[model samples]
Target: MGANDLAKGPQMRTVIFDLDGTLADTSGDLIAAANACFRGLGLGDLLDARHDAGTALRGGRAMLTLGFSRVDGVDPGEVDRQYPVLLDAYARDINSHTFLYPGTMDAVTRLKSAGYAVGIATNKPEGLAETLMQSLGVRGEFASLIGADTLPVRKPDPEHHFEAVRRAGGDPRKSLLVGDTATDRDTSRNAGVPSVLVTFGPGPHDVRALSPEATIDHFDELDAVVAQLIG
Candidate 1:
């Protein structure tokens, strides 16, 4: 019902994952899409994947804003106008360069085997998130996906995480959030759920500064970390 509700109800184990930079390295494709939009405007590739990886994970608007800032005449309005174009380009080739983090699927399988319901809570648009997961052949693996557009609010809005757990049929009180950004850490705190930040994301935030409940360098350590946090 609310953020407090996430800490109530029967204990039902669940793990909510942040898609980009957490479960998958989608920055390359994201940057490419943004670059495609800039190129269409005859501005050429405005952002580089290596340089703007963090912005890419933050989403299209962030990347567009950053790119537009670097150009001479582009403004927020132009960024807004080009946002849909970026999405269209991304949708056309969602999986061209996107890839799951190493050992992600194995960890996910282990979680499923251990009877923990798994779901996704990402800031990406709902349709794009669905498209990416389906294109990558892993849509069936997740019980639920709550994206930026899935509800009126998104992370660091805890309601997004709460809805994800509920949709997964898992009790929010027994849920853990696995992500790669401060936004996810805040979402977990707001939801009263333990947070685990992975070091593999494109974001530049120091995981130590975020002070998550736990930090993991690789998905290989996820099972033990999740068990320790919420099991």
Candidate 2:
């Protein structure tokens, strides 16, 4: 695992989170970085901060691919070429407009106080995830941090989620993933665990259609939902 961090806790169950859309609304900054890359190529802000928010959370490559698709005469390998550029630009202003979802830390505190191990499993790069958590002053809240680049594989793969749960000192059979995307739904399903998708993330309607074990309207509903699913 690259840049993954772990901690031990006495808990039989764990709640792993998907960082981008679930815990934090990082679309603004993500789009900015993607736009920065497009600007460097004289494309001039191919992505709109508000409109392309969903694509932004999908990851840098997706954003680049989308932008490339919109224009004529763009090279096929442009997305790959601009990926590192996007990452560097993103690192420069990772948290400029990023913010934790309402009641996020409060719910996390409740979970931790209630003896549930908490961790994050995200498709964002490991270093970027770590830097954002630290920048938001919430790095200490999670018992484990596993990012896309943390392992050779990522979300929608059972191993990625299992590693996060294991690192947090929780059993995979007793773990649940709280997230906002179909990839998360599949990860939990593949791992033989339940999932709780949040309705507050980008493309909430599509998320609902994925039909995870349950759905939450807000972080305030998380504890109850988690208890029902895994407790």
Candidate 3:
């Protein structure tokens, strides 16, 4: 059956997470990699984590863009040539300061222990996401991982979340999409699954306006939220 048909069936047994701000605090590595790229090109450091994060591409390309934009001596076209350099640097330093947000691992562990399948759905590239998950020591924990390139389209399309459900071998009617942005909320809505929006990340637009199924301030509240949902 098509992905759209899943949500209408039985309830989901999986919980899919959006990486980066949701599952891991990857800003440090992302920012450091960008700065390193800048220094490598002799442009010096220019972007700050809080502000530059919004400008970075959806994933690795964002880091590449941050670095390329800071290099004063390189031609804009030449930036493409330097992308490989930035990507290599990023992959090498993927988890330098990356860590799970407070209570994230515990929450995931708790969920799995309670028999809920856990997975990841992120805009980050597959390779980078895999590397980060490995570095964080949680690679084997996830039942499925859907990165940006996993499908022809990404978040805000609903397909990605459905694909995540498919990979987890579960139904979406019982699943919840947990993330930190409006695109994620949109994805859940389109997929006809409930979505939980985390407030501790980069949301280029107004999250409240996006109107997720629910909003959370910290990981500590997630368990209670889920309980509320399943009840």
Instruction: Estimate every model's Cα lDDT from 0 to 1.
Output: 0.92, 0.91, 0.77
Instruction: State the local distance difference test value for candidate 2.
Output: 0.91
lDDT of 3 by residue, 80-137 (tens): 7666766788898887777788888888888887777788999887788898898888
Give the alpha carbon lDDT tens digit for every residue of 1-231 in model 1. 986885565466999999999999999999999999888888889899897899899889899999888888766698789999999999998998899999999999999999999999999999999999999999999999999988999999999999999999888888999999889999999999999999878887778689999999989999999999887
Off by over 4 Å in 1: 1-10
Candidate 2 lDDT, tens digit per residue, 65-172?
Answer: 988888899998888899999999999999999999999999999999988999999999999999999999999999999998899999999999999999998988
What's the residue-level lDDT of 162 in candidate 2?
A: 94
Q: Which residue pairs clash in candidate 2? A: none
Better of 2 and 3 by lDDT: 2
Candidate 3 ranges beyond 4 A from true positions? 1-12, 54-58, 63-75, 202-206
